[model samples]
Target: MTSTEPDARSSSTTSEGATSQPSGLPRVLSVTLTLAAVTITLLGLRQIGSFVGPVFLGLNLMLVAAPLFGWLVRIGMPRVVASISAVLAVYAFLVVFVLSLWWSISVLVNEIPAYASKFQELYLQLLDQLQAIGVSETMLTDQVASIDKQQIVGLATDLAKGIGDGVSIMAIVVTVLVFLSMDAIDIKRRIQLVRDAHPTVADALTRFGDGVRRYWVVTTVFGLIVAVIDVVALGIIGVPFALVWGVLSFVTNYVPNIGFVLGLVPPTLIALLDKGVASAIAVVVVYSVANFVVQAIIQPKYAGDAVGVTPTVSFLSLLLWAWVFGATGALLALPATLLLKAFLVDADPRGRWVNALIASRPGGGETPDPDVPEADEPDEDLVGVDGRADGENDSDDGSKPRG
Candidate 1:
C-alpha cells in the first residue's frame, strides 16, 4: 500500500509540472504577439504624435508639479484651491517656456544676415590660411561661395516655425492639465479601486509617477544652475541674446548625454557672427566648463540615483525615444523610459530578466533593493501615502537603498 501511495504522488507531481510548463510553441507565440503589439503601438504613436505629444507633455508637467500641489494642501489650502493653484502655476510656466523658445527663434531669424556676412569674412580668412599651406583657394572659394547662405538660414527658420506650430496645440494641453490637476487630487482613491483588482499594476504606476517627479525635480535644479551660469558668462563675454541662449540651455538639458554640446552650437555661432573667432572660442570654453561643473560634477550625484538608469541604457533610450516621438521624445526620454521600465518590466513577473539588463547605476553597479514584486503580494511593505505599494527604493543619489 505504501509503495502504491508513493507512485501515485510522484505521478501527480509530474502531471502538475506538465500543466504548469507549456510546450515551446506557446512561449514562442506569446513572444511573437508581444512584438507585434509593440510594433503596432509604435506605429500608432508616429501617426498621431501631434495630438499625443501635447497630452504626454501635459501629463509629465502635472507629475512634476505634484509636490507643489501637496505643499499647497499642507499649508491649510483646500484641495480645490491647491489643484487650481497648481494648474495655474504649470500654465504660467508653459507660457514662459513657449515664449522663450519663440523669442530665441526670432532672435536667430533677425540676425541671420549678420551671421552670413560674418561667416563670409571667416571663410575668406580660412581660405587665406589654406592657400598659405599650398591648397588651391580657387577650388575652396568656389565650394564656399557655392554654399547658399540663404538656403541655410531658410532651413533654420523653417525648423523654428515647425516648433512654433506646437503653440496651436497649447490649448489642448492646458485643458488636459486643468482636468488632470483636478483628477490628481482624487488619484489615490481611484488607485485604491484598481488595487483591489490589479495590485501589481497599481503599484507599478505609482512607482512610475514617483520616479518621474523626482527625476524632473533634480534635472530642473541642475538645468537652472547651468542656465544661469551660462547666461552670465556669455553676456560678460559679449555673446548677443544671452538670455535666449540660457533658456535654450534649460530646455535642452532634458535631452540626455549630449544636450549641453547641442546647446553650445547656436550661441557660439552667434558669437562668431557678432564678435569674432576669439569670442567664439571663449564662448565654447565657458560653456564647456559650466556644463562640466553642473552636468558632470553636481548632477551625476543627484540625477543618476533619481533616474535609476545606467548611462548606456539612458543613451540608447534617447535614440529609441527620439525615433519614436521625434524631438519631444528626446526631451522626455528619461521619464518615458522610467514609465516603460515600471510597466513592462517591474509590473510583470515574466519580465524580471529585462530589469536585470537595465536596472544599474550610471557608474555600473547593482541597483539597491531592486523592484521585484510578485502579483500575489504586490510589495505591501513599501506602501505610499496613497496606499499603493512601490517596490522601487530609488535613492536621491542611487548609492543606497531608501526605507
Candidate 2:
C-alpha cells in the first residue's frame, strides 16, 4: 500500500475526489458541528458578558503583575506571599482613590444647593447687566427665560440620576477588581487558551497583557499632564475649587471626548456664579486652550503607538462596549480593544488593515518574505511564535534564538 496524499498543485483534485466520496459528508458535518459549538459558546458567553468583563480584567491584571510575582518567587518568597503583595499594592492605590473621591463628593454635596441658588442669582444679575449694556429688555429676558421651569427641573433631575449611575460604575469596578487580584492565574490561563497556535498564542497573550498595562501607564501620563495644566490655568484664573476641578479632570479624562467637557462644567459654572459672564468665558478659554494644547499637540507627540488601534475604531468600540457593559466598559475600552486587536482582529483576514489602523507607527503594513532556502525549518529548539518548541530543540546544540 502507498500513501497518495496530494501535493498543493493537486489539492483541487484531492478536494474534488474528497467531495465525490462519502468522506465529504462527514467532513462537512464535522465543520458544521465545530461551527455550531463555537456559536453556542459565544452566545452563552454573550449572555453573561458582564461576568466576562471582570474575568478579562483579572487576566489582564495577572499578566501585568506576573513579572513582579515571579521575581518574588525567585527570591524565595511563597506564591501566597507574592499574591498578597500584588493585591496589597493595588488595594493601597484604591484606598487613596476612595479617599479623594469621598473628599470631592463631600464638597460637591455641600455646595450643590448653594450652587443652584447662586446660579439663579447669577442669571438674574446677568439679565440686569445686559439690560444696562443697552441690550433690549425683551431680548435679555427671552434669552434667560428660554425654557419653562418644568423642563429645566426635569433636566436637573435626570442629571442627578446620571451622576448616580457614574457612582454605580465605580462600585462595580471595585468589586470586579478584587476578584481579579485574588485569582490571577485562572484568568491568565483563560486568556492563554484563546488561541490554537501554541507559541503564537502565548506570544500574543504576553503582548496582549503588556499592551493593557502599557495603556494604563500611558493614559495616566497624559491624564496628569491635562490635570496639571487645568489646575494651573484654572487656579490662575481664580476659579473656585481649582484643586477639585483638577481632580475632576484626571478622573473624567479616562472617558475621552466627553472628559474635557465634564471637567469644564463645575469650574465654568462656579465662575459664572462668582464673577459673571466674563469669568465663565475666561474659564472656557482656559479649558479649551489647555485641552487643545495638551491633547492636540503635546500629548500626541509623547504618545507613540503602543496599542494598535485606530481612533474611529476606538470611538466606536467605546460606544459599543459602553452600551453593553455601561460606563465601566467605556473606561476599560483601551484595554479591551487591545485584547480584541491582539487576539481577535489580528488573526482575521483583514489583520493587516486592522494593524495599520491601530498602529502608532507611520505604517503597520505586513512585510512579504522573500523566496529563499527553507532555513532548515528553524531549530527544533526554536520556538514558533507560540513560545513553545519541541523537546528536541532543548537537546540540540545551540541553534536557536536566545530566549
lDDT of each: 0.72, 0.60
Tens digits of per-residue lDDT, candidate 2, 169-261, equal 456656765665555523333333432234344444455665666666777888888889888887888877889988877876765557677
Worst 10 residues of 1 by lDDT: 380-389
Misplaced by over 4 Å in model 1 are 15-25, 74-76, 99-157, 228-248, 251-275, 288-305, 361-403
TM-score versus the correct structure, for each prediction? 0.72, 0.64
Task: Please give the lDDT score for candidate 2.
Answer: 0.60
Question: What ranges in model 2 sit over 4 Å off?
Answer: 1-71, 108-124, 130-164, 185-197, 255-258, 296-304, 345-358, 362-403
lDDT of residue 38 for candidate 2:
54
Tens digits of per-residue lDDT, candidate 1, 1-403, equal 9889989999999999998996666777888998898789878887887677668878888877776776665566766787788889998888777677667767777888866767888888987888889888777768889999999999999879865755555777888998888786655555655666676777677667776777778988999999999999998998888998999888778654556766888899899888889999999998999888878666655664676776667767768877887767776777778777777766675665665566655223323233544343322211123222233232211223224
Query: 305 in model 1: Cα distance from truth in Å?
Result: 4.1
Clashes of each: 0, 10
